[model samples]
Target: MSAGVESLLALLVSRGGGQYGYEPVSQLAHALQTASLAEAAGEGAPLVAAALLHDLGHLVEGSEVERLARGEDDHHELRALRLLKREFGAAVVEPVRLHVQAKRYLCAREPDYLAALSAASRASLAVQGGAMSADEAAAFIRLPQAEAALRLRRYDDCAKNPLAQSPDAGHFLPHLRQAQAETRTAATRPDSPSAQTGATS
Candidate 1:
């Protein structure tokens, strides 16, 4: 495995067992459940991998609880995307970056969707800029990977069930490897469009 992949695995192994803020499930359980939901939805490996690591920023920052205690938005999506973009393609990074916005979009567009969020999620939404306005929701959907972000967002919200079960993190090894390989191959292609946009495309 690549050093980047190993590092990610190590972080997850060492720190993913903590509580997911005020959620009912542990961070690892949430990640696994999100990935399981994505896989069951027939998403590609890149998306499943994205689901598996979406909240990695919380771990990377190592202060989700502290930040929430102080009433701050850690902006985990941007942090995780920046860290993962060097080794993972846009298929994984973009969705992570947009998942928060996807929550806002759903609140604006879907009837009663906001009511479904956990209390902690509802609290975070306020610090997350609250629900998007109509125009904001409309424009957000136009972005690349917006749909995927929405799908991942739904999985994220639903994954908090303490009764849920999921596969171990090891099950995602192949997906991470595949995503990293795709990222490296794209970076090597000087003539490829990703060379211009980088992994954020």
Candidate 2:
């Protein structure tokens, strides 16, 4: 794997806290579950990895209040995306930014969507401006990565399984290593040749 991707993946696997409230299902575990679900649902490696690594900013930045009080930014998604962009480029960062918006949009547009949300999500929805008007949601839908963002949001919801999902966390380290290797390989491919040759025969 490329050194950058490898390093980033290592950081993510090691740094992630467990899911928001439950100690048994860590952030890393949640990420692994999300990635696995995305893969099963036919997402590509990058998207799967994106799912796995999306919340990593929380680890680096700490909780929102702590970060803001410290005079640093509190938005974990932005911090995580900034770090990833420096390493993996925009393909990884775009979805990370949009996932939060997707959640808000879903809450606004899909009447039934809120019913499926976890308690934490439900509580945060209003704080996140959940009462946004239809016009606000429509504005969000116009973003370029809206669909992929929605897909990631769906995977995020499915990642929560306090009992069944806990076991899978054990397997995440190896998968993270493999993903790092894959990222490295993709980064170093012969882009110049492909760009110059047009379509390879």
Candidate 3:
């Protein structure tokens, strides 16, 4: 892993200090599941890594900072994306920025999407201004990466720890490492189209 991702992993380990909310699940477990699901769904390594570390800004900045950022309506995606961009490059940042909007877009465009959302997502959707209008959703669908964004959303939704279907946290480490390594390779490749597209195309 790159020094940055290694540092991120360490931060996640420490921040998982304990469980919040209602279950025995650790924050680390949640992150692992997110990565695993993204990988399984055929997301590129950067996207899987992005999925895994999407909430790291909250861990690093703490709830108070997060609250302040959110009070300004600033999304966590940007904070995380900025860090990833600085450390990795555009390849890792674009997907992170798009993930949140992917959720919003999916909820607006897909008839059954909202029903699959976790309680947290459902609540956040309201704070995110909920579904988009038909015209807005139609316009969003025209974006080149919209399909990838939708796939990411699908994996994200399935990543939740359903009462009967949660997987072990350790099962995800190998995939996370693999994805991280792939991201590092892709980011450093001189010929990568992502480099030309600023990673968003």
Candidate 4:
């Protein structure tokens, strides 16, 4: 496996028993559950991979999940994006980058969305800049990855069930490998469609 993939698996497995911020489930459980939801929704491989590794920045930050209780943003989404982009394409990295903003976007457009957030999510929302203003929401919606980020945010919110069963990290390793390969291939192929937009390629 590639180093990025190896790091991902190690992080998830090592943090298997650790709590997911203020959620009841462990970090591994939340990651697995998020990926499961994306798979069950018939999302493509890239999206599923994004779901699996979205919070990798938390792993990058080590104990930042604890700092959330103290109101630190930690900027996990941005951190994960930088780390994962080397291995994955924009389809994966962009969603993880925007997932936090997705929460803010949702809070701006969907009247009931904020009410559904867990207490912990609600707290972090404030540190995350709270709901976006109308102008900010309009700008956010125009992002190419905005819709995907919103979908990921939905899966993220619902993946906190402690009793929910999720496949082991091993089950998702192949997809991670595939995503990395796709990214590398796209980046090197100037004639490819992704290359034209300079998005992931």
RMSD of each: 3.4, 6.3, 5.3, 4.2
Best by lDDT: 1
lDDT of each: 0.85, 0.66, 0.62, 0.84
lDDT of 1 at 158: 88
- How displaced is residue 8 in candidate 3, in Å? 1.7
Q: State the number of backbone clashes in model 4.
A: 0
Candidate that would win on TM-score: 1
Q: Model 3, which residues run further than 4 Å from truth?
A: 18-24, 62-74, 162-201
User: What TM-score, computed on C-alpha atoms, does each candidate reach?
Assistant: 0.89, 0.74, 0.70, 0.88
Worst 10 residues of 2 by lDDT: 181-190
Candidate 2 total steric clashes: 7
Error of 1 at 12 (Å): 1.3
lDDT of 3 by residue, 81-186 (tens): 5456535544455566667788888888776888877665676676666788888788877876666666666766665563424344444445455655555545
Q: Write the per-residue lDDT of candidate 4 for residues 31-144, one digit (tens) a residue.
A: 999999998998877888999989888877656566776777889888766557657778888899999999999998888999999998998998889999999999999999
lDDT of residue 64 for candidate 1: 78
Candidate 3, pairs of clashing residues: none
Better model by TM-score: candidate 2 vs candidate 3: 2
- For every model shown, the clashing-pair count is 0, 7, 0, 0
lDDT (Cα) of model 4: 0.84
